[model samples]
Target: MAWRKLDKMIRPASCRAGCWRCVYGCPYGAKWTARDFIIEACRDGAHLADRARVLRVLVENGRAAGVEVEVQGKVHAVRAPVVVLAAGGLGSPRLLHASGLGPRCSPFFSDPVVAVMGSVDDIDGGAEVPMAAGLSLHEEGIALADLTLPQPMYAAFAAQVGRVDRLFAHKRTLSMMVKIRDEIGGGVGPRWADKTLADSDRKKLAHGVGMAKAILREAGAHHIFKSWHFAAHPGGSVRIGEGVDADLQTSTPGLYVCDASVIPEPWGLPPTLTLLCLGKRLGSSLAATRRAEGAA
Candidate 1:
């Protein structure tokens, strides 16, 4: 909402706080993600992509060939004799279910980001490049960052009412996060189909909340908000070795997935970089096979 109010200054309570209209929703304006990377790859492939979203994998004789996808709200079927599934975490599992391939396929999704908000006269963290420059900490399934949201969203932040005033005074209050690269367990609750979020996940996020608050308090941030948000980087369904294979190919031959959807667990940091690298490898492998076939 911060970005929405950037020019109009939507709320009255917000103007009184001096936070004004800043879109801290994503501290980093560069929302460029894996989707952008895939589009570029498709562009490079030109006639190959066909710009379609596979709705069902057309499997015949169990070898897995061709697919049915929705184009401009119209379902279109294409026969390729070989198909690839790179639908990412959320859609991949559903695809499997619809195809009668995977019923027990774990939801294997992760977006466990930790949100932080503290007052700062001049937010230095937001100035960093690549959105998140460093990690507050990391483990197999946890990542921390200074998630940048717009200023307008912070209107209610100033009114936390208690010890938060000192944060702006200290000029050290800023947003930080601890994203969960959590283990895939404790199945997601209801409403996950829409948001890919879970309620139990909050417990894991609290750890980051405590740490971020302490860091800012030590850095001189007071009058801070106790709440935080966790999002971005949802995947793990169709995980390699479990749901999919090492090459990101599912049990169904010739069917491959090349996006965050294949990752079995969160990397606890920026995964797009690594995902792109993997996609590159996949593309090259596919191109090589196609070239050999042409020569034959």
Candidate 2:
């Protein structure tokens, strides 16, 4: 009702969230993603380097001056006056730790999703986009989304069903997912994750599973199965007020860290929109800062 009152609700093409393009890369080039934005930047004269793995941020006089990256089995140093770490939550923390910037940020969380799989009579799940409709079940600390996986993925879920033929009925399958708000209990490592879900997080996930099961059953699905967990929307590593200042400046001047790494909390929502807004704000600030420095 509030969305209607504000006239802010949006119904995308096909009257759904358009999951077909999101899950699988959009062959038609219709999906809006960060790649599209980056491509536009490149067209606007921004240089893009591909496959250069940043080994560490280079610091001189306690200020970030550039980065050491490896490309094609060779190490190279890229120098710049200002260095920005736009690596995501995981990669950013790893890079910072490698550069001896800060200790690894612990108690981070990611959205872990488990899909509830079932089948309804005479329905082709692949007939339309998956997760087209969704609801925010905030009271339960979960978000509900419609789902339709490819045939092989569905088979993996039905592995214990004893009959591969029955499980192969992808068209009759009905899928939904419950994404729970997880507790922060994970630690980010330089190259690997040493994180575990908290007991509370597991309980919340179980509750979400129950909700998914109920919804599927209510929609005439039976022989319910549960898929393994997968993590998405990782954040809360180098958080605001801890790893960086509100201005996104690190202890190293002329250096900044933005992206999901600076998200202070889980948010229980997609990071795309939030990150875009943050990028815009930070871009404006950086431009202004550059202009001021030139004046000085």
Candidate 3:
């Protein structure tokens, strides 16, 4: 496994107070998020309707029309020649189901994760940046990373694993995360989504945990234990070939999905960069279509 530092935007000096604002909402704007892009879009004359929720996509004569949404408890129909779904993995599939599009989104993947942690003698751990360094074993469909959770989160993990006695060892604990790319075998609906790990996925996690424990032992850590399994970046609910086309256009013309939901397979790593690239590509494709229509 090749190890390296993760690319993240954080000012360590700003976190001296240990408020952990970065974990929830960075008040200092030190961490980059979708909000930054929204701000830029608004400055470019894009109207952002905050607190609005889309109920369904409006299809007319088997073509894209617009969407029905609710804002401030009132229903409204916003008409458009094109519609793009960027509501993310969960929201996108739910919207599609509600719109009578994909009746059911089945076989999705949620990168299951677990943190293997141990107590170190002297080093302070919880105060550092989380996921600072890590390695990815692509062939094995596993990724390992150094992680330093906030005290409360660490305590929650410890409690989850029935390790209450080690809850107070946040400062002197060394933690590493083992995340596995799980098989797509779940269903998503308008109201609920369900996922279950395959046996292969469980075995992969166990192997990753063993590797993490060995590394922590080499680093002088003891009392090694793993946290309860959790999930991250749930996706593949709306896939490329099955739900959308090469240009990310759905069966309905002029309608597109540009989010993690469109990813075709189980992905082990973070999807942020992938989503950004998809968004850009979709934007360009839409612009080109608009230009062709204008010329015709």
TM-scores of the models, in the order given: 0.70, 0.88, 0.93
Winner on TM-score between 1 and 3 is: 3
Report how far off residue 125 is in candidate 1 (Å). Answer: 9.4
Whole-model lDDT per candidate: 0.59, 0.76, 0.87
- For residues 1-296, write the lDDT of model 1, one tens digit per residue: 01111112133332323331234322232333345555775788745545567778899898787888887789988888667776666666777777787763355556666556666555544332213333534443445555454433333434343444543332344766566656554332222443344555666677656776787787676556654343466677677788778877888888888877777665455566678788888888888989999999
For every model in order, what is the number of clashing pairs? 27, 0, 0
Better of 1 and 3 by lDDT: 3
Candidate 3 C-alpha lDDT tens digits along 37-116: 88998999988988999999999988989999999999999999999998888888888888988776556888999999
lDDT of 3: 0.87
The prediction achieving the highest TM-score against the true structure is 3
| All candidates in order of TM-score, best leading | 3, 2, 1
Poorly placed runs, candidate 1 (over 4 Å)? 1-45, 48-53, 121-130, 139-141, 152-173, 186-191, 194-204
State the TM-score for model 2: 0.88
